[model samples]
Target: MEELSPTAERLVSEFVRTTRRQGAVPSRQVADRTLELLRQLVSEPGWRQTAQLVGQLRAAGRQLAAELPTQPAVGTLVCRLLKMAREEHGAHDEVHEARPHGAPPSQVDSLHRRLTAGRGAAPAADLSSELTGLRANLLAGLDELQTELDASADNIAREALSHIHADDVVLTAGRSATVLAFLRRAARERAFHVLVVEGAPFGGGHRAAAELAALPRRVHVTVIAESALFAMMARVNKVILGVHTVLADGGLRAPVGTQALALAARFHSVPVIVCAPSYKLSPQFHRGDQQEGFLESVSPESVLPYADGALVGRARLTCPLFDYVPPELVTLFVTHTGGTSPWYVYRLLNEYYDQQDHEIVQV
Candidate 1:
């Protein structure tokens, strides 16, 4: 397998290290970083052919995935880049296939031959032109991916007013950039109260509440404990949460306390809305037989600080960083494309992630 270019190596290393250390690095950032690394790989001079470049990208993507096995976005971005490469390669092959048998080589084909044979110190004009075009197409695809990443939140947020209303109490758990943006967007048009569940062991809900309160709209924010979810359900009009991954079966992997919130909302017949970008939709199913754990377990110390070995050893603190919320608990999904039902999430998965890359181990 071809090695990653120096620049690609550096970019991947930093991203992997940061993600592993920080934990819960936003999916958007991970997609952007992966695309940036791909852009560099496409432009690197060491590649002899498009196929060679694709092989190297796959190798680099595997390395990135290995560094963070729980991050599906990394693998998703790689699959996208691979698709682009395949498209270009297919087009190039078609052009060659259309050539008349035993005909004189086209100028571009001659240049390719010369470059392959190492007959010149520098590439010919036509070879340079072809390479430039290929690089532009790959870079353009990456740029489009970046734009999609940047705009996903705003696109999803645009549907907020349709779901939220004046005096409605929207309950959510933990810190979700998607949920926060959706609420803030709705708050601009409607006055509402937000009940944030303080997802303990991390207390991310406190930070989420503060950020929501900072919005310019008229909104009331309350930070409540996870234990209080059922108590608050009767007053809540809706539950809006964000997901770490949208499984193929339409279930979600969310911050640890999400399952409780969803269950409570269901008990009270409160609608649960999930805000997610298309990139978070994974093609893999979370069925008992399938492997869909992009979820990670945090340091047990976060649950019970090292008071002493005597106490620490006595208690087995199992703190999973995320919880699985079945699709049955979710009423609707707000995506970049618009609002969809939980069952429709399967379509979004088909749109974003390729079947071939569904298994990260194989991809």
Candidate 2:
């Protein structure tokens, strides 16, 4: 139940404020900021043990999730960091136990042992030095994590050519930087037609089309209405989209119109490809779970303008921000690590996260 440090408190407040006001912030940016803030928190000097640091991090994570319940990136990155700390601590312990008794730290072949050679039952006078070494290892691991985050988009984009082909028709809805980069990379070498469904309420598809049209490639872009998605599905060769989070069961929590689009693609026998980085993978299962904050709703003004007083007062408008696309609808998932089947998501989740920290943020 340790409280967050002053630095952690300030950073978390700023992130929550900016995210609440500008809901358009990309998940990648949110994740990067979250990781940076966590790195800063890990560097602050007052921790006596790994458990204390973990508690403070969990508190900051809960605070972020409470402020922005809809954004999964905040919680995902927090859990990942927690796992990293635990892994480093475990490695430290293993190395310490494996080393020869009375041997100098430098003689140990393991990098972790060489970093810190101290028993878990060390005297109080030596605990500070032990923690200091552990902190250095954790900071180094975070640096590597930051590098991975920065390169995730490009890594996923590299596989675009493998799926998209010359003269193929690609259908997508909404704006996803990962999806955009994937198409951009494919269009550079292959000539393809992109059909962008104008996802209403947000109209993110319009912006997607504009950016695709501007790409310096032989890519032909077309903007289609959401209502026409079903009619146009027959002609699409592949449906490439992006998601906000990949649930543990392999289902997707994607843009609002994604379910309809996936259904249409399935009916037409079109392959549906989802572009997402490994960080978007969550350990939480959405099926049959009564998690109150699982989904989010936005202002209905875009769907039903308040200016139309007659219908506004009579009709109850609900515009959900996301859609749930079951794993069956997804033919393939293109992640930073490469292509994976929807069924394989569970394996990736296991690799990226620890089971113990799955419910770190209860809300």
Candidate 3:
């Protein structure tokens, strides 16, 4: 495998840093960036065989997955790239190996000329031609992946009308673009009340409430504190929340207060619906002890910035960026394709990731 150019290295580093600092970028954006990075990776200076390219892609994928183990999209995109390469290689083999996967050299080497002029002057034309076709097809496949990422939000939002009813109260937490888009889509045809839970410390819910209120629709928007979750449950017809990751065990890693919200909804028998892109569906099982490692922790100052330094220094505050919401608490998952039960997530995972790549970290 050839080394990546300086520009590609910088792009990868920037993505890693930005993702760590700002944990709320949409999963679709992350997937798109990952796909673009892979495209650049394959374009590096290398005129290798299809098998060699596939091996390099796998190695690069392992490195990228290590950079951000919690983001499942990185691994999913990598697997898709590998599948494309293998398919192209299979097609080339059927053509009697007459063409190589790499671009053919402008000048073909003759045996007598090769023996006299040395091997460095030219490359085999067949190998070069094959690579040209492989790169083009791989890029086209990447473009298709990007298109899917761009369309996911709208596709998922289209199903809002089917799940939401007129004059119902929809409660949600955090400033999730996915949830906001879903609600706004439904608002176009029906009027309802939306209660945004103030996810304290971050207060993302306040921002979400403000955005929802500003939408040009008759949907009533209300912002409430986390403490008021249970009290307001009776009034909420449904809980439509967004997630950071959906583990294969049918559990969700969501906003810090989402567990409480889901619990309240469960107690009241109100349906709890989760809105997320299919890319966020991870192939790993959720481990409680390891959840903290996967999730980001904000500064303690966000919760007690005004407190005395001495008191703040002496106390340990656990402010995790996300919380676990078990499958049982969730009634349904509304993804880009359509709505389904949480147990059905494994099937989606199978479609997106390879069986061997299920534990990407191990790879």
| Highest TM-score scorer | 2
The ten-residue window of minimal lDDT in model 3 covers 103-112
Off by over 4 Å in 1: 1-15, 21-24, 91-132, 287-295, 308-310, 361-363
Query: For each candidate, what is the lDDT?
Result: 0.76, 0.81, 0.75
**Which clashing pairs does model 1 show?**
none
| Residue-wise C-alpha lDDT for candidate 2, range 1-363, written one tens digit per residue | 458877778878887888778766888888887778888888888676887788788888778877876677888888888877766665566446776788754344335433555644323211112445777887888888889988999999999989998999999998899999999999888899999998887889999999999987758889999889899999999999989888887898887888889999999999999998877887887754345454577889977888999988899877877777889999999998999999988778766776656775432
lDDT of 1 by residue, 1-363 (tens): 447777767777887787778766677777777777677778787776675676677778778767776676787788777767655654565456776677643444445555766554432112111333677788888999889889999999999999999999888888888888888888888898999888886888999999988887658999998777899899999988888877777898777778888888899999999998877776766655234363456688866779777999888877776677889999998888888898887666555544445665221
Across residues 1-363, which tens digit of lDDT does each residue of candidate 3 receive? 433346556666776787778775667778877877888777765545765566566666666677777676887677777766755664565443554457342122123344766555433223222545788888888898788878888998999999889999999887888898999999999999999888887788889888888888768999888888899999999989888888787888776788888889989999988887867777777776565334667677778774678888778887776777889999999888898798888778655664555655321
Model 2: residue 101 alpha-carbon error in angstroms: 17
Model 2: which ten-residue window has the lowest total lDDT? 120-129
Clashes of each: 0, 0, 13
Pick by lDDT: 1 or 3, better one: 1
Report the error of model 1 at residue 57, Å.
Answer: 2.3
